[model samples]
Target chain A: MVNYLAGLDAVFLALADPTRRGMIERLSRGPATVGELGRPFAMTKPAITKHVRTLEQVGLVRRERIGRIHRCTLAPEAMRDAEEWIERHRRFWKSSLDRLTRHVESGDKLTLALTEERDE
Target chain B: MVNYLAGLDAVFLALADPTRRGMIERLSRGPATVGELGRPFAMTKPAITKHVRTLEQVGLVRRERIGRIHRCTLAPEAMRDAEEWIERHRRFWKSSLDRLTRHVESGDKLTLALTEERDE
Candidate 1:
């Protein structure tokens, strides 16, 4: 669990950049060469490489080499982890809200029951 | 569209920290005073304030001043936006993978057709 939380830190950090996010969006469609991934952005080659490295380090993007060519693709595991964290919290928040509603409704019912008893 | 993407950058950046995430997780359960939010971590007040500021700036958290105390709660909008972006891209990626599978399956069908024709 500790390692998973640590990975969440790196995953969100990697995704915090627009350019890197764009590259991931591109790779989501299909595998691409490093050059292909960088072509859509106006960033310099070094900047692109740095962004790619960050994504690779977070395990969100997989980069492999075949002789002279480099391929990059979406790895999905880190992305899934990040999604799960947000989703789990969302569920927690929703359930707590449900509990609060039930508590309030029960309070109202109790108040009504006491009023009826007093009238009788 | 651009403004929304810019918001995503800040949202993810704010979420990149473990302390901020812990605060968010706590806030999701219910509202808490600024001091209450800060009590979980063994950090200085300034550090906690900085993290809270980051979350507020990204709009993931809303902080309000009530009398002498400041209260914080999960805003949910930015978190929803983040979830939407991930879900949309996940759908895109899944569709693309399905297309690739169909393409390969069609290729296999063509090869089988040719093999049957030769046998006849």
Candidate 2:
């Protein structure tokens, strides 16, 4: 669980940046060289590299070097972890709300029973 | 879109902290007072308050003063935004992979046709 939370932390941090999200989107199409990844963004090569490194750190993207070229692909599995985390919490809250509704209904019934007993 | 991205940034940043995520989980059960929210954490009241404030800033939890107590409730809508963002990308990647598979299949067919023609 500690490792999972840590992985979640890294994933959220990596996703917080618009540029990084764009990179992930671009990579989703297929693997691309660093130059191809940087082409759409109006940023320096180092800036793009930093964003790529952040994605790599979170395991969101994988880099493989073929000759002098660095090819990056989207590691969708890492993204699945983040998605599952959010999905778990979303379901948690939904069930929680259901429970809260049931609790309130039971409380109302209990109150009604007490009032009837008092009157009797 | 910029506003949406900025909101996403705040939401992800707020969720990056385990403490804040815990508070969110606690709030999911139902509305709770500040004291109740702080009960699970080992941190000082002030520290817990800071985390609550961060969550409030991102609209993840709503705070309302009733009598002398402050009640915090899970604002699950904000969470939906984050979930939707991730879901969108997840779908994007899934479709992109489908397209890539089709492209590769077509390329293989084209290569086979050329080789057959050359042999003939």
Candidate 3:
């Protein structure tokens, strides 16, 4: 069995929360300071800080502090694994369904041919 | 703020578990019976069932009972929202980075012109 037990688990868990996903959405626009990242939320500074910490821990966001100002930036590479996993699964499912469709179509053709022979 | 509080939360939460991810990976190839889905794991049948139920609740899997056997299938559409979320962020991040790169390159060209004039 293929195991995605490392960073993917952390990435998905961090993304499971709406606050963090919102932070990611904001940072995806560009890097922002802690206050800026928290602007749209009614959350306390501490709560937003906690959510950013979760993203930082998951390697999804990088934080750098400069004299009381912490800037958060999206580490886009961090999402690569999770993205690839979903892409791979989608591809597999699509291809499998295509195969299933082809098989069913061929079966129908066979049935039609048998019926035609019986009619003749 | 873009709030992904609904199906996206459940989707990412369900994906956070490796076992559930594995089950998804299996079903992506095609649907399977509960026994077949559990074949690769050392876990109990109930454990596998629990994991499948979690996936089912999240709309990532569809479960159907045929006699005593339960058929588990991938609900690929359930992943579309989560996929779109990542894709949107990725597109924004990439485009923003591109803009940043362009800005920096333009600045570099200005600096080069200044240096050339100084050399002249």
Per-residue CA lDDT of candidate 1, range B35-57, in tens?
67787778899998888888898
DockQ of each model against the real complex? 0.27, 0.31, 0.31
Error of 3 at A4 (Å): 1.9
Model 1 bad stretches (over 4 Å)? A1-4, A96-120, B1-4, B98-120
TM-score of chain A of each: 0.76, 0.78, 0.78
Docking class of 3: acceptable
> B1-120, model 2: which lDDT tens digit per residue?
223468888898888877887777777766677777777678899998899998998988888775676767777778788888788777777776675566457865533322221211
lDDT rank, highest first? 3, 2, 1
Pairs that collide, model 2: none
Cα shift from native, residue A6, model 2 (Å): 0.9
Which wins on TM-score, candidate 2 or candidate 3? 3
TM-score of every candidate:
0.78, 0.77, 0.80
- What share of the reference contacts is kept in model 2? 0.49
Tens digit of per-residue lDDT, candidate 2, span A1-120: 223368888898888887888777777766677777776778999998999999999998888775677867677778787777777777777776675566558864533322221211
lDDT of 1 by residue, A71-112 (tens): 666777578888888787776777655644564478655333
DockQ of candidate 3 against the true complex = 0.31
